[model samples]
Target: MTTMDLHSMTGAYALHALPDDERAAFERHLAGCASCAQEVAEFAATAARLALASSAPARPEMRERVLHRIGTVRQVPPSAAPLERVRRGAARGRGAARWALAACVAAATAFGGTAVWQYERAQDARHDAARAERQAEQVAGVLAAPDARTRSVRVAGGAGTLVVSAGRDRAVFMASGMPEPPSGKVYQLWFDDGGTMRSAGLMDPGRSTQTVLMRGAVDGASGVGITVEPAGGSRRPTTAPIALLGMPA
Candidate 1:
């Protein structure tokens, strides 16, 4: 690979996204490329610092959630050569405490630098996340809202045809054209997992077919479902499903 390609892959490499062939090539380059390896180290350290910026203000629940998410991703240890070098120097010293203090100072400095870098990255990540969420909500609003004169019910073409962009604490629905139900009954949305049913929202009949449908966050309907119920709606579907959609929780 060219030097430019190798340099560009540093971030992806740190994230471990490179394919086997690409990873082998990069590792081969890194073996002889001190500059590239150094750059990789810096990027990895910066990523670690970015993680620190997301650190909560010492709350138990927040800490638990953070740890849970962190547990899903593989942890990459920081380069230890600097610490090793310090330890060797400490070994040559007459007193362990003095060397230990020096080592602590070094660690503190490293952490401080990393924390600052991570704070900026965290801010940037937050901004990006907010922007993405806004765009998503706007799209959801458009899909859910039907020009103020109507309501919508999302009808997926098939299983896995719908994608709902929702946070863990929120429920969201993305759907397309669905036929209106028969008289004396309305289409009620539900979240069913092959067993019990939970109400999502009451989908109003559209003036015509082939329209968009969106639903706000609702309690109980963690999964998506549709069933025919009373005009006003039902707490749960009493009959079989008219349609259903689901996503992993």
Candidate 2:
């Protein structure tokens, strides 16, 4: 691979994500480049800290993901040719993008921004896997119903879609890039049961995309709607709806 390509592999290298060939190639690259070596060291230390922090109340999937991650990497063969190449690449003054990405990940770990946060989020997801699987099956049922139909929707920041199965009294909401609600507020879903709206659930803050099954019964409901409310969500919509989507009979 080219120098740029190899530089991009640094994160993967630190994470033990590279395969045998690429791992070997990168170690050769690493042996010569002090900056990359230093960056990798930071990555290793940061990951080690997170690993320690995430150690308690451990879940089996965590181990599974790690084992499945790299299948164990082999030691890199000895190399002696990074100094000259590092000097040349530095003189040209390029390839900062890759290092920036690596540094950002390390920094995020330090700030509790994403690296460990996302891993913990992943653990949360795993905890809900059974419920998610059941939801998936329910959504499948809605999609496969004889009367099922999908309709497109428009929201301020991005498009939305609704799949309705009146025969089954169920619906699914799918959207991407939905704008975040104003501070101290959240997006709430509702089942427009005739003229009466029933609380569904709150959309996750900062989540830009998702496909979710609307909670509660859909029977006799006109459709679904979204409204901004207090962060913990409102018993009923206190603000005007940002968007209203009607269901078909």
Best-fitting candidate, measured by TM-score? Answer: 2
Q: Rate the local accuracy (lDDT) of all candidates.
A: 0.57, 0.73
lDDT tens digits, residues 1-249, model 2? 998887777567656667999988877776555456655656654665754434367798998898876777665653457767767788666568667867876765564543344334333434455466688899889878999888777876787888888888888888788888788988888988777779878887687798778887787777788888999998988988877888855
TM-score of 2: 0.48
Q: Cα deviation in Å at residue 37, candidate 1? A: 63
Top-lDDT structure, candidate number: 2
Q: Model 2, residue 49: what's the lDDT?
A: 70
Q: How displaced is residue 162 in candidate 2, in Å?
A: 1.4
Candidate 1 residues lying further than 4 Å off, grouped into runs, are 1-161, 166-168, 207-222
For each candidate in turn, the TM-score is: 0.31, 0.48
By TM-score, how accurate is candidate 1? 0.31
